[model samples]
Target: MAVELDPQLMDILACPSDDHAPLRAGTPTDPDADVLTCTSCGRGFPVVDGIPVLLLDEAIPPADSASTSRAGD
Candidate 1:
């Protein structure tokens, strides 16, 4: 089930990536509607059991990003 986060919490939440971009909740039509998407990096952080998993390793990067590695990687 898709988790609904509080507006206040959402406001404080940001992507864990180096960009530290703002996050937007996934739309209902999205396959990963339970995720929180980074506005800048296009990575999706999963929300599990009402808790957001903001770990970079757990984040799903954008499809196009798979072909490219980060600067250090």
Candidate 2:
């Protein structure tokens, strides 16, 4: 599913790993990417279905294999 961001929500959202100030909407890895990143923590949060999966277990480090959130699968 594709995640949509609310203009109001974007200003308040911050990285879970670290506040890192406001998160940037797009990264070099992706332009249409729904993930937002914390420059300080280096953790990326992927927003899906208009909800941000902020849980450490739910979030996966950017991978090359596929866009699977399973870190230990």
Candidate 3:
């Protein structure tokens, strides 16, 4: 199921990185896939079961195809 995040919450959400840029919502191809991307760093944070996993440890680094491809592993 897709989790619809509140616009107000989205507005307040910012990247936790040094850049602190605003997050962009992902356009999921699947119902269960949702993410928030940092505009400055290009890091991706997964959203599971309607909650965004915003932890820095859980973030996907920018331009890392290997990490993204192996995400399911």
Candidate 4:
């Protein structure tokens, strides 16, 4: 099911990363993923039971971030 977060809350929600970018509902990869994706870093923070888990440890980093880090090695 699609998560329905308040528009006002969404507007205030920011990614808990160094970028601290604005977050939007769901992700670019999956619109119904029940998570909020960062506009800058593209990390996806899962929403559990209507509560947003914004911790960096809980965030699913963008696929490219993984590959890019590996490529640098």
Worst 10 residues of 4 by lDDT: 24-33
Each candidate: what lDDT? Answer: 0.83, 0.64, 0.77, 0.88
Candidate 3 per-residue C-alpha lDDT over 10-41 given as tens digits, one digit per residue, 9 for 90 to 100: 99899998879998786333334478878788
Ranking by lDDT: 4, 1, 3, 2
Ranking by TM-score: 4, 1, 3, 2
Per-residue CA lDDT of candidate 4, range 1-73, in tens?
Answer: 6668999999999998887899988788778889999999999999999999999999998978878899989
TM-score of 4: 0.85
Q: Write the per-residue lDDT of candidate 2 for residues 12-46, one digit (tens) a residue.
A: 88776645456666554675677776555556677
Say which candidate scores most in TM-score. Answer: 4
Write the number of the candidate with greater lDDT, choosing between 1 and 3. Answer: 1
Q: TM-scores across all candidates?
A: 0.78, 0.60, 0.71, 0.85
Clashing pairs in 3: none
How high is the lDDT of residue 47 in model 2? 75
Clashes (candidate 4): 0
After best superposition, candidate 3 residue 39: deviation in angstroms? 0.9
Model 1 per-residue lDDT tens digits across residues 1-73: 5559999999999998788998988833485489988889888889998899999999987755765666448
Of 1 and 3, the candidate ranking higher by TM-score = 1
> Residue 39 in model 1: shift from native, Å?
0.2
Q: Of the pair 2 and 3, which is ahead by lDDT?
A: 3
The clash count of every prediction, one per candidate, is: 0, 0, 0, 0
Candidate 4 or 2, higher TM-score: 4
